[model samples]
Target: MVAPMSVWPWGNLGAFKYLLFGPFLAQVLYSRMGEDTAKSSWCLHLLIIWGLRLFIHLLLGSFGNMLFLNQTRRIIKQGVDFKQIDREWDWDNFLILQAFVAFMAYYIFPSLADLPLWNTRGLITVLVLHIGASEPLYYWVHRCFHGKYLFTNYHSLHHESAVPQPVTAGHATFLEHLILTAIAGIPILGSNWLGHGSLSLVCGYLVVFDVLRCLGHCNVEFIPYRIFERLPFLRYLIYTPTYHSLHHTDLDTNFCLFMPLFDAVGNTLNSKSWQLQKELNSGCGNYRRDIPDFVFLAHVVDLSSSMHAPFVFRSLASLPYATRLFLLPFLPIPFVVMLAMWAWAKTFVISFYNLRGRLHQTWAVPRFGFQYFLPFAAAGINKQIEEAILDADKLGVKVISLAALNKNEALNGGGTMFVNKHPDLKVCVVHGNTLTAAVILDDVPKDVTEVFLTGATSKLGRAIALYLCRRRVRVLMLTLSTERFEKIKKEAPADCQNYLVQVTKYQAARTCKTWIVGKWITPREQSWAPPGTHFHQFVVPPILSFRRDCTYGDLAAMRLPHDVQGLGSCEYTMDRGVVHACHAGGVVHLLEGWTHHEVGAIDVDRIDLVWNAALKHGFKSVSAPRTTSSSKSNFIS
Candidate 1:
């Protein structure tokens, strides 16, 4: 069998007083039954007044309780943590006792005796004094409660509800509540004795103050700071929902009732509270500081010292108006010095070595001078390299190639080959992949003259062309196939195409020659030849011969007579545009005249030697046609 819990009738007596007597007294007072009463009659009149106030407060409290209960039910149904709704009414009796004692001491005692301190003038003085004195007293005593000695004994009960509910406002040890109430009453007693005021005034002040205190500690957000803080006078002195809510949550600072000035002046304000408020208002997650050290200091400081002494002292003697006026003229000197230092540092102090390292490691080196033999490949290779070379070339424009050349060997045996072979041809190569294009382009030097494309159409090539075109870069296409060449030309926007054409024309005029290589002929297929022995030639100056078996090296090896110097010069000039010509014995022929006459022949070996020499001279290798293995086998056979 389970044991039965003992019942205490007194436990429910306070609740009974609230429910039964509250409404009856409210009706009597609201009807103004004791407005013209003497001091002797005032006690009975106040009983009616307090009863009415309590009645209305309980009515609201009941409604609030119903709302909270409904919310709790909903929360439970939604599977919210039950501990969030944890409630304990253990301190209700103590709070009731405190309220009873305050009512007797402040409202009831003098009513019975018409004491000089109980008059209207005395009450007014007490109300005014209470406003000024109660706050500082509460602040110091509250600070003491938080001290090491009192916290564990008296203050811990209040802190038991870390997330305080409305009922938890006055929940504390009986002695603790009595001590605080007595401290709060000191101002009223002292002020009444100093300048006696009215009972109505005193009662009104207590009623309003208690209401505010209770509402401030209420769990429900009735008085939103957003609305209340906007009021002019209320914004200054009265505490808002936020102010008191922070006191409960923070358990420090905001100890004063009427204003925050005391906290600010005392330097005991919880800096974290201000930071939290800022973060909450700004919707920023940037609160860095946690606990404020001053809160602990506030706890140790003696209450007498804190309450009696002014928190902040103002003294004009520290720095007179004359001193300020004297210093005003020199302000510009510091400003001028700072400005000059900033300008100098910005212009000359910063080091380029770090930038150079970043460029070398992360950014692709700009290809400035062209080398025909080496090719570079990487992400955004075409665009980055082209931009870099163009930015680097000032005197003459340089073009970039879509070729793979290792960074380590690029200067000696890579993209530099094109510049070395054709000293007059300015070009460079930038290496990158799709991921690196943006970085490479961003860091590309400003001297590159042009960007050139080789091989098939690729994203990198298109990106490079697009980037250069956007930056008003001179972009040139040097591929072997008319299919891709025409596609690129057509795909390019009208403005970009026009720009590219203008750049090409300008480059051609400057070099005095332009070569259109590979499959980009007027009638595309006209250049395509069948496999096997066939004559390949071009029409040029009369100095060179169009032969099926002639090479450039054979022409050089011929050591033509001195009288034929004009023919050699003509041949050299024609070779600039003549990209390739195949001969019957694997030779390259230099065709001459308007009809491409066979005037001279060069063997394959001689052609190879000349190409090798050009390679040695730094001429990048042009992409050759990939012949089928069957065709090569048949040629060998």
Candidate 2:
């Protein structure tokens, strides 16, 4: 339970806490517009500090994620869960509070407004004051917080994140942070009082402090063991992530803030700290490095959606993906990252989670979804997919599922080329289009005897057509290619062959209330459907909702089983704990221990079987929030 003293006055404000800075921001703007430029730097200083703290926190988190992916220098093996992400979501609250404190300090000591840009002596002053005053002051105060009274009320909130990330360093209760801000301000304030202070000194000292704090909590070992081995006394001067991690795990040892020297002097240092540091540095620690049972091969949807990757923004990634106006300024960064990936073109693991004691990971091809449509990109995209599949095969992965574009017919014949090329491979290559078809088919109402279908020549379209025909449901297959339509119709049983009809015009489906869109459709084409027509889509970048009288279904998706753990990030635009049907399809294959390759043509006969397996495994169909109870039951049941 949170103690009354620890609760922030404006804690409930959340994002609205920025409103507190409005007065300060307005002052800066007014100063910039008028002749009063003295307070401008000071006001801007507060804003810049907040921005820098946020930047470094995100930067370190991104770097840590990259290390986790490369699997070399990560100190902790466990991924951050949704709870930790949400807990650290308001990490910048302290920065905003600190700005208020600084404003009060400046009001009391107006001389601070006239500081020099640089002071050589200020560096020495900051170093001496921080070491002599701040370090020991923090050590004793930190130990006291661990006592029963404070631990339960205040300190425990910060310690909640066992496997800490960069943002974790700033996640503390209001009272705990109030004490910390004083400890951090000592050196800078001392330097100012001693007449050795400079703007550069304050900025430089704070930035370094933020960097080291983030580094210690980053859960990644970066300091080489050789550094401590070369100079034995250095271990006591500076602490590593391993040393600080022990403080969280052991709860009684390694209590020094950044310098282990105080811990040693206080006799609170963990004896195992040096050994664990050695083990992590040597890359043979107890950290988990197990091979995943299944891999979901996915690609970036576009420049904007790319930022939804787990490494970019933990808070944004935790929710379903959508374009945010604030993210537009950072679009160029993703463009640069995309170009960098293109230069180093390859597949890399982006995120992973565990379910039912099985490891599953999502791997990304460097190419974006739009690139798949470029004529020149087809070969490179195929090559990356092939390499990912081969690597999974070599790693003894039980199954690898291809994303929509990866299994495009024009790219690699729905992944048939990879399976046929390596016919003897043990790993199951799955397109997962069977489950995609099943999900779309399940959404159709039972009484609907006739349905309109688009993209009839594609793999999913073909499977859907054949499956519906077998049910004696008349399928209006929209395609210009009669030859392709005839081929799909011939695959159906002789008795159901008459259920499939070829149509080249949207006018043919004017009366059909159920429309399955396997391809993109224009607003004009969508208008051809009758009023109240419900559109079920399997297309990437789903079609627009144009008619108020009609409802549109979301892309095929399923909520993961209740047992899923460490699934902090959403899959693309899917909701938390929900994934595209293709991804779930691959997982079902792994759980069912199916050894057969699910590539090439989707088995129409296995639609019900796969759907049943998904249901048996507790996977539920995901319906749009706007779907009414009557509409939801028609699809979900």
Candidate 3:
């Protein structure tokens, strides 16, 4: 490089000072010489240009970058894992090449005397046309470098820093450094080729350009996703730190430098980038903006889940501060009551997938499944119903179907009690007795002539008795009193009065071959049925503690046999493959896109409608009609 000095007579001593220390000398001389000196003489302009470059890139750029990095460390204390930091540190030697790249760019363009001062047109060319023309050229070069031969031998070295630092922008080999220099020159040199560019414009562009380059590798997310949400058109104009991070993590994607236009044109943008943006948005300030919709869509305990299911944690946080304040006056009274209820109850939501269809559903617990437990004995029955409904709604459950005891005891006018108590709730509630009975009746063995229908005194029991009566099966109905029994008999379908047998004693139903348990029965020694008897339980969580000895489980409980292929983790709470028809009826309503509960009397047509829905949605019988277990699992036995 010093060979030039040997040729010129006075160059030897001058070359030593000017070539080596030109930028430093320029900085000092320009500071003292003033602007008039720079404008008057090209010699002074020459030194000042080098001086400005050194001042901006070496001094301001480095110091501002350090401050930004330090502030970022303060903002996020739980930084990357130790092993990742160590892995990145091992590649620190690569960043030293950056100065070499910068040195090449500084001297390679032209002598100061050859370059013109910045004109307005040249500045415009550098700002817009340079980026526009360079982007496509750089995109292709990047794609070529990603190819197998080039990637293995050269480009892969730059990818060593998965989470990059500011200095990592220039962490490339000598060949890559040349490639980087070329891509960077496209705007400056390409514009100069078109005859509108100046060295002043190129130098000025580099100063601003390096800021974005360093910021891109800073491993910081400085852009808000909502900015793109509001002004999506600008997404083409900006490249976030997250954008460049994607380039590192997903090596073949997002190859464009400053904008996404070519990447979109090439169709190589990482699909996960948008998803990651939404996840990042959730933690960002936009959470407050989404509160109204979340509050509107959320439920306490939803049996049906939708695609727009609200975030469960968001819903929990959305619980009004007023709710806590309302308990304040009552203080220890309401507080102690809640504490008592907590001791006595457990709450959970169970999800089921593939539904044999496009949708999935969840079952929230603390429900009145059966009478065996003290909670189901109506101790906290109202609270349980409220808890389930509230949580399901909070989970973004669109609708809830009150099944078994949830219908009769909690709300007297079907679901009206719940509606009145929770007027603010948007989750639709249904008694679902009509379709439930229809589904249950479909489970009754065709050969069976008699069914011991418990809870005959209630609306659910009466509905099932009618379905059985339609089938001409003898129904030995149990009622709480003779008065309720006579009322049901008179209200019952008159065509089969002789097939209906009213009994006050449950023991009398023992002679019946089949049982319809719409209500929970206590698990006393006398309550257990004989060996040949089969049971269809409408109740959930069975009154019995899941014993194999309990004569027949809910035959009405249907499951999707093919559902196992896509069930995923939602199968954790399922028994064999069967889901309770009552709990499942809500899912049926959801799949059918119905928002109301066809309950109270009985919707026989709805029964047929949902039966077809069950078949259409891929629900299959979990076991043989009278089989002791299902092939779904050994646990069923």
Candidate number achieving the greatest TM-score relative to the actual structure: 2
* lDDT per residue as tens, model 3, 102-176: 444445544423557665677776667646676787788889989997787767767864446554565555566
Model 1, runs deviating above 4 Å: 1-46, 49-95, 98-124, 220-236, 272-637
Q: Which regions in candidate 2 have their CA more than 4 angstroms from the true location? A: 32-36, 67-70, 625-637
All candidates: CA RMSD (Å):
33.4, 4.0, 21.2
User: Which ten residues in a row are the worst by lDDT in model 1?
Assistant: 291-300
List pairs with backbone clashes in candidate 2.
Answer: none
| Candidate with the larger lDDT of 2 and 3 | 2
The reply for model 3, stretches above 4 Å from the true place, is: 1-275, 282-398, 403-413, 419-427, 522-530, 543-551, 560-566, 569-573, 623-637
lDDT measured at residue 295 in model 1 versus the true structure, 0 to 100? 7
| Tens-digit lDDT track of model 2 for 166-213 | 888888889888998999999999999999999888889889998999
How many clashing pairs per prediction, in order? 66, 0, 19
Position 93, candidate 2: lDDT: 74
Q: Pick the candidate with the highest lDDT.
A: 2
Which of 2 and 3 is the better model by TM-score?
A: 2
Preferred candidate (TM-score higher): 1 or 3: 3
| Full candidate order by TM-score, most accurate first | 2, 3, 1
Which of 1 and 2 is ahead in TM-score? 2
Give the lowest summed-lDDT range of ten residues in model 2.
628-637
